[model samples]
Target chain A: MSAAPRSASRADPSPVPVIELRGAAFGYGEHAVVTDVTLPVHRGEIVAVLGPNGSGKSTLMKGILGLNEHLAGTVRLFGEPADELRDRARVGYVPQRHTLSSSIRSTAEEIVATGRLPRLGWLGRPKATDRQVVARALELVGLSDRAATEVATLSGGQQRRVLIARALAGQPDVLVMDEPTAGVDVASQHVLADVLARLVARGVTMLIVTHELGALERLLTRIVVVDGGRVTFDGPPRRFAARRRARDHAHDTHRHDSELAAGDTAAVVPHGPADRSGQAHA
Target chain B: MLEILTTDFMQRALIAALLVGLVAPMVGIFLVQRRLSLIGDGMGHVALAGVAIGLVTGLEPVLTALAGAVLAAVAIELLRARGRTNADVALGVIFYGGIAAGVVIISKAPEGTPANLVSYLFGSILTTRTSDVWVFLVLALVIMGTLWVLWPRLFAVANDEEYARAVGLPVLPLNIVLAVLTATTVVVAMRVVGLLLISALMIVPNAAGQLLARSFTSGLRWAVAIGLVSAVGGVFVSYPLDTPSGGTIVVLAVLIYIVTAVSMAVVGRLRQRRHEVAESHEHEHGPECGHEAIPHGDHVDYLHDGHRHAAHQGHYDEHGADEYGALSRDDGPTGQDEEVST
Candidate 1:
């Protein structure tokens, strides 16, 4: 069964975007990293945001997650203003793997149980339903056997899965991940891809910020490429590949013929995967 | 030891020590985990200023110290939130400022002020009044109750602050509450370990517990146990040795930390050797032994230095290398390339 769009109905008529950003700019403090970007993520859609380092892809995701407030324009979650959305449990966030410090000595079960914090009461006691949800999340990530294991003792791949399980336990309608596969092993990446596929099949909307598409290439319904703090391209993966190749060719000829000004060099050098895969695609 | 416990003064001191011991480490465990161990020191300095204020005004030093500490805690949190400086820098500013202010305030006070200041600074557990014991008891209950109610939120914030914020955990209020708790712990512990050594009481036992513990709950239990033993044992030893009570307690706690750290290293080495032996045996046995016998070397490496090992392992992994390549290729003009590796 396909995942139903949350809160979408005939009376509403339109499928409310799970995440909506119009001319949004986001950054830390006074410095804006992602600017003038308009993007909408519909229900059940898997969107991959690709960008170079310091290109503000993560910042954009942070804006949607409300970790970083939008400096400009409007950001809406489930048809509500981003900052005003009270139902945070509906949007689960899986940050980069290293975000969890090594000093944290929690078991996988304990970590997954934390995802239930929003659903829990002030005392933060996990009810039977919470426990069952946490268990199911661990099972979904194929980590039920390792549920009691200390996260510190788990492999990098296993730790990543635990993080995914933590987000899943929230039962969020939308999953936002920042560089899910970065620094992960190839085998683990494949495992993550399978997990993402299952999540998609379950109708969970995903907005992922990543450098390399790799195994995630197949699961993506749309790809958004950011360059120099702006959304340069947003379309289907196939069209992205086609457009990227054409852009790379034009960039190559421009680089070879032009006097190579600093501005020219910066513009031609597609940050992140675009630069590395430029030749491969050509 | 039994004879020493007979006197009313000794009994009061021991009770205070035990009470501070139980609550201090409970608070300290969270502080250490959050890398805010020095917050105890900062609050201790502020407590000194409070003590000076009490001396000059003829008020109860403990109550004044508690008030001073709470105010200082709020100020530190405010400064940190305002981004006037980084956390450590802000803490350092308040830490030294409080001590300096206390010194200046004490200098202008009555004749006995300096002596009282010294006692507070170094701690005089033998001189701990019955009223002080009651105050410590009340503070312990309040602090422990607060921690009990806020355990999950505090743990989430301490473990991964960004994740806590993303999950809509009230990170700011939780942080302020933690700061206030740290202040309370420091103020209460100051009677046993002194303002100067309060952080030792707040850090050493928790540090030792972290080394020995494999889980959060176990770490907390171990910390409280270690702290209690150190407090009572230090007082017991101090009476016989004729040493300072606060210094003795801090020394014992430090000794526990050192011993635990060294033992962890020794144990890690032995485990590494065992893993090496197992790996060699697997190599000799060939493909039938399976990849399970291959031994995840990173696990052993992590025990040595988890942060560095994790970073290195991330770099050494196949995907990390690919990302590194992609990163290096993108290092075009900004000269900010090394960031991607980290």
Candidate 2:
């Protein structure tokens, strides 16, 4: 396993990455959707995966969640190989909001309680502590009032919170969410942001996949940009935005040369006339 | 009706009906909730082929039919898992194929075979033997025991299969177990309600229970209650009215379903109106309440209860078609044609 240095410390040798992927390729069937990805997520960091539509951002999240087939390379969770990490309760996953079939007539509390399935012994009923944890999860997501409400009766935003609360009820060390703000109203996004900020303050490791930053931009510790099934940029959010602005400026100045440089590393690096002269001297 | 119970055959028939009534709906509730209600009918068709095979081979028809239904259930599950065809399409193909095979096999048999086949097709509850009653009792006990032990895991799988899988539950085996249980229930039910009317027993009472009950366990109890009432009541009514027992039972079940569905809708509407009035009153007291209420308006106006209007609309359309097919097969053109041919 390649031990990547944490961004917070340059020389620290003991801080293990909570999640590590080395040249990982994930997909379904024979096709690899996300390939050659190397990333490490440490504790107490909120990493946002930003990408265009159909750019394999969701696939990358699924790879981390072990929802998809890992065709090649290694994925480590909590310092162990992903496949060997059998204690799934340590990692929480909040999937993208999809309409649950109406036949499943469970309340928000009941759905949240299912998160404790990994913790409970087979055939064991929910204990008082489990119920309290469920209640606390609901409270964390601002859904305490809707605890007894049927999930189908709740609005989309409320349903999303219920899903998040379900993951929280497991008391996981790492929380991964896919498009948590997509299709959510602005007010609900702000509420999610507030809840996430609290989770960050509590030292929960978060990996979020989203197309747009929206309300979550302020909370992002790092931004990883994926394009064409590969990670194109990995750095702080401000540097990403600055690099993007510089690239756009270069595109406006020299459209033909920018087109020619599309697949090159220089397309990503911020380049202007001054940088070109400095590069020539070097 | 009470005097009819004095006869030996009537006593056996009553026992059979009661056993089926209590147990069939217990399995049926899961099938209906999973939207696999048609599987009962499909298995019934498969059992018909088994009965025919038994008659030609000089074996016990009930035992043969049970074997056939179970094999068909396993086949259906395997095929569905393979995703070769959609569930309904696969069931339809197997169902019609089974019936067609039975017809061919029965047609090749002696003249007396068709008469016996019709009895199995439409059910002859009054002709049930003591041994049949014993078989029904054993089957009911087995079904109930297995379900009791596996209820929580089965419920989890039925409720959300993918989520259950993610939680490391044995979904595939639970599904197969459920299918096997359903097949057993169908075979047991065939002796009382007949192949044509078996699905009505499995679907109507359970769907009605879902409409009336607020929770999963309560819904199951309601279904069993409804099934028992319809079964016992239909037998009593059939004795007095001189009607076919299976047809009467299905009709009673369908009637109960309609009444419960209408009443639940009425109750839901009333509660919705009351809640709206309270919300509007709050809006009048404080303009800020209006802003708080707008999102809820769309939710209640469309969803009302947890039941999604669109999903229910689709379900009703499909259910209506199935009910129509079941009723027609029970006493309509198919039944008349069989009588004429025989």
Which numbered prediction scores highest in lDDT against the true structure? 1
Name the regions of candidate 1 deviating beyond 4 angstroms.
A1-14, A244-282, B86-89, B111-115, B276-342
Task: Output the TM-score of candidate 2.
Answer: 0.77
* Model 1 docking grade: incorrect
- Which interface RMSD does candidate 2 score? 14.5
Best DockQ goes to which candidate? 1
| Cα error, candidate 2, residue A273 (Å) | 49
Off by over 4 Å in 2: A8-16, A244-282, B85-90, B107-115, B277-342
Clashes per candidate, residues 3 or more apart or on different chains:
0, 0
Tens-place lDDT digits, model 1, residues A154-211:
7677677788888898889889988888877665677678778878778788899998
lDDT of 1 by residue, B1-342 (tens): 588988888898898899888988888877776877778888899888888788788788788889999999998877876766477677787888888988888777777644466678877766688898899989989999999888877887788888878878787888899999989988887777799998888788888888877778888899999999999889888888988789999899999899889999999899656532111110111111111112234231111111111212123211112222335444332322222221
